[model samples]
Target: MLQRIQTVYMILSILVMGALYMWFPVVEDAAKNVVIDKSEPLVLGLILAPVVLTLISIFNFKKRQHQFVLNRLSIILNFVLLGVFVYRSLKVSGETLVSEKGIGVLLPIISIVFLVLANKAIKRDEDLVKSVDRLR
Candidate 1:
């Protein structure tokens, strides 16, 4: 069912976000030795907070309105995170003249896409329930 899919997406997103947080210290240490700026870890945290919050919001899906609000907030936060990453990438690209590929880029993109799909599924579910109620 769509609800199950949404649940799975949320769980996966949560796991990914948590893993990044857990590994951040090690990553920061590694980055420090490199020529790149050390502020990447803070930027990563800013990008991840909404993802973690969105996963927490999934538990409240039984309350349709709340779920909708949470999903909207998640979407907004994801956009903000995306913007930050893009800006940072551009800034670094200008300075270094070479772009670095990292796990951070892919994870946020995947999480955002999944969150968007899950939000659509939630809306469809809500409409279906409303239609059924009208038929009663």
Candidate 2:
């Protein structure tokens, strides 16, 4: 199972997320001041949650159903994280507080795409198993 396509997708998602955390800024001001980043507890937690879930999903690959569930949950969390980024960028005084929205904000979307592909692969595996079981 570790060699499955879903595993590759999950690993790529993890790398994207890690890159986002390590080097990207979510929002920065005109003075190069970071407005939101890993330093913010809430943002940090939100970013980490999906990575943790994906890791769990990778390790639980033997249980396709469980892995699929974990991916779904990770997707939801990523959506929530994206919402937070959007909200921060759209604040009424955003012009003053956040002069630039960083490319990091789009990292979650990339992660989500990878998770969706992983889920699709997992579902295909599940269906194949079910079909084989039906034959026996």
Candidate 3:
């Protein structure tokens, strides 16, 4: 169930990011003073991280060991990404508190929740594995 939720979250995140990129020029024009450069590596990082993590999650779905590591790593990565988002949000929010730019803040929060849930699911799987091992 949690894995499925995570998958859905990743799909949504990717779609949101793609939409932002597609409409970036218009968004920047509306903001007037601020310009969002989608070409930047940082923007690329934000877009690619979730994609890679999602693929990893899907590939390791049946492989317990890999799923454990991938889920844990995803949680850590989500936290790191959250930090980045918060920092950027703070910097941008300082200029304009109620702007389209503020929408970026929601992405990290959603991603973090999904990643944490994935980690919990992975931990549950690990416990089940240990219990089965003990049965032997």
Supply every candidate's count of residue pairs whose N, Cα or C atoms clash at under 3 angstroms. 0, 0, 0
lDDT of 2 by residue, 42-135 (tens): 8889889999999999999789999999999999998988888878666535354444455667899999999999999999999999999999
TM-score of each: 0.70, 0.88, 0.66
Compared with the true structure, the alpha-carbon lDDT of candidate 3 equals: 0.58
Query: Which candidate ranks first by TM-score, i.e. highest?
Result: 2
Which residue pairs clash within candidate 2?
none
1 or 2, which is superior by TM-score?
Answer: 2
lDDT of 2 at 61: 76
Q: Report the error of model 1 at residue 68, Å.
A: 2.0
The TM-score of candidate 2 is 0.88
- Please, what are the lDDT tens digits per residue for candidate 1 over residues 1-136? 3356776777666676565455433222233433323246656666567666776677786876677677677767666665765565544422332333365456666777777777777788889999999999
Clashes of 1: 0
Instruction: Name the top lDDT candidate.
Output: 2
lDDT of candidate 3 at residue 112, scale 0 to 100: 58
Model 1 CA lDDT for position 66: 76
Q: Tens digits of per-residue lDDT for model 3 on 1-136?
A: 3445545554564465455456543223325544445466776576567657666776666775676566566556556655665565555533552356555546655655655665666677678889999999
Query: Per-residue error at 104 for model 3, in Å?
Result: 1.0
